[model samples]
Target: MHRPAVIALHYQNDILHPDGLIRVGLSEDDQKRTQLLVAAKKMLDGARAHGWPIIHVRVAYRHDYADLIQNAPILKSVANIGAVKEGSWGSDFYQALAPREDCFNEHVVTHKRINPFYDTQLCVLLRGLNIERVLIAGVATHSVVESTARHAVDCGFHVTVAADACASASSESHNHSLNSMRLIAEVSDVQSTLEALK
Candidate 1:
């Protein structure tokens, strides 16, 4: 059996919280689409119950924004909004979806880019754990989730995405990303992923 780790990507307040800075720009319907805390909580519980390694991936930049690359439109918007600064509340993981201390050797990986694997120690950590497969759940399904899943496949790790545990700016974008990822990764809901892990 493949040893799988659960990588929860970018559950930061700036992205998922109701009062997040980015929320100021999102539509009400978009806000509704981001109601992922409950589903993420369930996924975490299942992963913990099965003793699967849980990795939390967050994106945060230096206080002076020196480490931030504003090449991308989304990143430029992030800088303009003053979101996700290191040590800021907006950069912290959403409380309910945070990894518990008792969770199976929980790991936290910070990245400055959308793809968690880029310029981060995520792959090294997974390799150290002998992880052969990864189950991903996170916010902005069309961005981080899709980017990371594609990179994971290139890195020779089997990927599974917990569909219900991921959210995006809107349902259409979310589903579109999921459909695209289906070509290279297994797409399953939280319950199905949990059951398979069990």
Candidate 2:
């Protein structure tokens, strides 16, 4: 069995925080939000225990929004609300799942697009680490999570999405994305993935 790199996408405050802007599909219920956090942390802890590489991905734009593509409404809103502005509180990772400073092996990938690899060093970093497979999980399972999974596959890396550890704008959205991803990647729960890491 090959060791897989864990790619955690868009767990930043701007997306998952209760006060954060992009709130439509994020877990609104207290119980549901807590469960998502716990599941995400569990997978990260499991990766750390096994010495697997963990990559935390975030999306942020410049103050002037010059770096933003200005193509989609969501992208436009980011600029309007000044969301995920670099060095802003909204850009920071959520407290619970933020990467530890002492963890030398933990990596961070900052991107402007939904796909973490685009115009980012994610692919080079994975290649340099000799990574062949990736375990992906993140907020809005229908967006960044699914987009990155598809990109990872095209990059020739075997992709697996940790289904339970991910959330979407709605349950239907999450399920639909997973079903679409199933054609190109393996979609499984976090526990099973951790066991596979062993």
Candidate 3:
């Protein structure tokens, strides 16, 4: 059986583009992503019930665009990329998923390329805590969750993708990534993961 673990949930902001595209950016109070908010709460509730640690990773860039340009060159070249940058409505953590004042011992905020651990201290933090199993739930299943799952597995962590705690830009993208994850990691629902913790 796997040992006790911490959870990683990616909270991000969404933007309504003039061309009818919803851009993924930094999460803030105003963004209020309904699906991700529900997922975050579910993760927290599950973790609390089992006394597990929960770590939140938020993605944000710099307002000057220097950060993305320096770290994620491909995304920088893409036109009208959506990412939470400082001093913008898109940069704040969505209030709905915001941790209560005392839920976490520490937190991580970063501007990463796809994976939260990339160029970020997330891996080191998990290592320091001796975490070998991770329950992941977050926005854009094909993006953050998928990216992290790959790296987590490579790093030797038993990874579980909470399906109910995640969503994508479209249903197709969601299913596609889930299928991909099944080959790399375990894919489960909120209840199943909760049961495992129990």
Candidate 4:
């Protein structure tokens, strides 16, 4: 059986759909569709009930755009077009899927890159816990989730993507991304994955 901590990737509150413009903030419907807040909740709930650890990998800068400007020029340029900024609602996790103080066992990384493992302490933390399998969930199915999944596999971690627990700007992109992930990792919905874990 797989013993793993659920690694919920960055659920940042920026608009990452349509034209990749931050000005296109998530509306009520977009939040429901893109963030998949309820799906994430179910996954977390299952993990909590099973007494499994939860690692939240949030993306936030240190109140400055310098890191992104220096390390990720692509992100910096997008910010120039009104993308999310540090310490803003657009930069924080979505309200529904906010990190829980009591249940949040690890904040493995505060990332600038799309992949949470890149230049972050994620691998160190996991290795310290002797964790080898990672159950991935959270926002922007194509970007953050897929990016981290790819890197996690590269780092020799067994990765499982919670399909319904993730979302992207579009269904087409989300489906394609999930399909690609299935080729490289375990891809399933919350129920199927939780059942397998147990």
**Model number with the top TM-score:** 2
lDDT of 4 at 2: 46
Tell me the tens digit of each residue's lDDT in model 3 across 118-178: 7888888888777888888777688888998899999999888888777775778888999
Off by over 4 Å in 4: 15-26, 30-35, 62-64, 70-74
Q: Between candidates 2 and 4, name the one with more favorable TM-score.
A: 2
Candidate 2 lDDT, tens digit per residue, 21-98? 775456557665777888999999999899889999999888888999989887787788778989988899998899
Tens digits of per-residue lDDT for model 1, 18-73: 78877433444554444466678888888887888999999899888999989999
lDDT of 1 at 149: 97
> Which candidate, 1 or 4, would have the higher lDDT against the true structure?
1
TM-score each candidate: 0.93, 0.95, 0.80, 0.84
Determine which window of 10 residues in candidate 1 has minimal summed lDDT.
Answer: 24-33
> For each candidate, what is the lDDT?
0.86, 0.87, 0.67, 0.74
TM-score of 4: 0.84
| Backbone collision tally, model 4 | 0
Ranking by lDDT: 2, 1, 4, 3
Candidate 1 collision pairs: none
